[model samples]
Target: MTALTLIRHATILLELAGQTFLVDPMLDDARSHDAVEGTSNPTRWPLVGLPTGAAEVVASATAVLITHTHVDHLDDTAIAFLRDRSVPVFCQPFDVAELTERGLPDVRPVDEVTHWRGVAIRRTGGQHGTGAQADLMGPVSGWLLTHGGQQVYVAGDTVWCDEVAAVLDVNQPQVVVVNAGEARMVTGDPITMGADDVFATCRYPGRRQVIAVHLEALNHCGLTRAELACDAAAAGLEVTIPRDGERVSLFQG
Candidate 1:
């Protein structure tokens, strides 16, 4: 059985096959940072407040997995919290130096596959955007975990691209976690998964269940949960969009 807790935005607590994985910990109050150059620059971002048991959730994390160095994904508060604990931090090779420089001494850069507690943690390439836009978005990564006869794919802040298709084709994760907020800048198209991207991922071959996160917390995100649900229904996908502090499991009865 797997327990997935959607803390807020991109932060997720995944407990699968007795191993607990914390993916992208953005631990702090809403509006903690300034808005990006483009996008809805509200006086404060994260329109909503922090989840109920945020501190406890962070404390319960067995291991931390970071996909990128974006502030929204790895905030100062999370870094402080993680530093106090003795858990191992897994991230892409590029982010190893930055995180280690940030005082996280136990950071481990995962190039290909790493083993932890009998689970296989693998790294995959991602296209944060297309063409020149991708360059601007910087380096990002997706993660795949195989355990307990199940494969889970955590698609980081990326759009629908060949890299994503390759991950799906090669890994064929049964449970797919997508950052679906349709987040866009004031200038270009959405940088995150939009309705079309969500539909495409849900319809991908061999994907049994899809979980969508990274919505409603930030001002830049234009897609709402209701809107994504409508689009998923239209695409015939029964996706799970958990709210803040909500938990959804992948175990079948």
Candidate 2:
């Protein structure tokens, strides 16, 4: 049995093929920092607290996977936590230098197919947004983890675009993890997956499971689980909406 636990926002604990990975950990407590400079909702960060046992989850992880270096995804608190451990961190090439400069122990760039602890891993491409917004958001990466007969794709911080479609077409993963918070800035469009994007991804022609996360913890993230669930159902898409601290499992036959 493989399990994915939604700890909060973009942080996830994925236990697959007898190995554990902690993805994009933001373990800071509520109101830890100022909100994005210009976002309409300028309240202090993390509208909610870190889930119980969040520290334990960090300590138990066999490795760390980071999609990007945004504060909401990889905060100072999480960096400190990782600095104290001896775990390896897998991330996109762009972030390798930054993480290493931050004093993380073993920061490995996922430039190609790599195997760690019996699992096959591939780094996938994604655009944070289009045009100017994309420039501001910078580069991000998704990950494909395959072990045994099951494949899981973690589609990190991307909107609906041709790259995402290509990933779906080429990988055909059994499970797709989506960031569906619809986070936006004060002047630009949404920077992350909204209900529309999530609905579209889930409607792809397959029986795969969609795990919708990255919702409701931050002030700028306007999308809610109830809202996405309603919209997804209307669009004939099935999604697993896990609350903060909820755990869900996938089995490989």
- Pairs in steric clash, model 2: none
Cα lDDT tens digits, model 2, 4-66, are 999999899999988889999998889998887778887898889877755686898999999
Q: Tell me which residue pairs clash in candidate 1.
A: 39-186
lDDT of 1 by residue, 1-253 (tens): 6878898899999987687899998877867767766666665666777776557867888899999998889888888888788889999999988998899868999999999998999998887767777789899998999986788889999988888888888878778889998888777777899889988887777646788999998878889999998877876778899999898988463
Worst 10 residues of 2 by lDDT: 49-58
lDDT of 1: 0.85
Superposition error at 118 for model 2 (Å): 1.2
TM-score of 1: 0.96
> Scored by CA lDDT, what does every candidate get?
0.85, 0.88
State the lDDT at 170 in candidate 1: 81
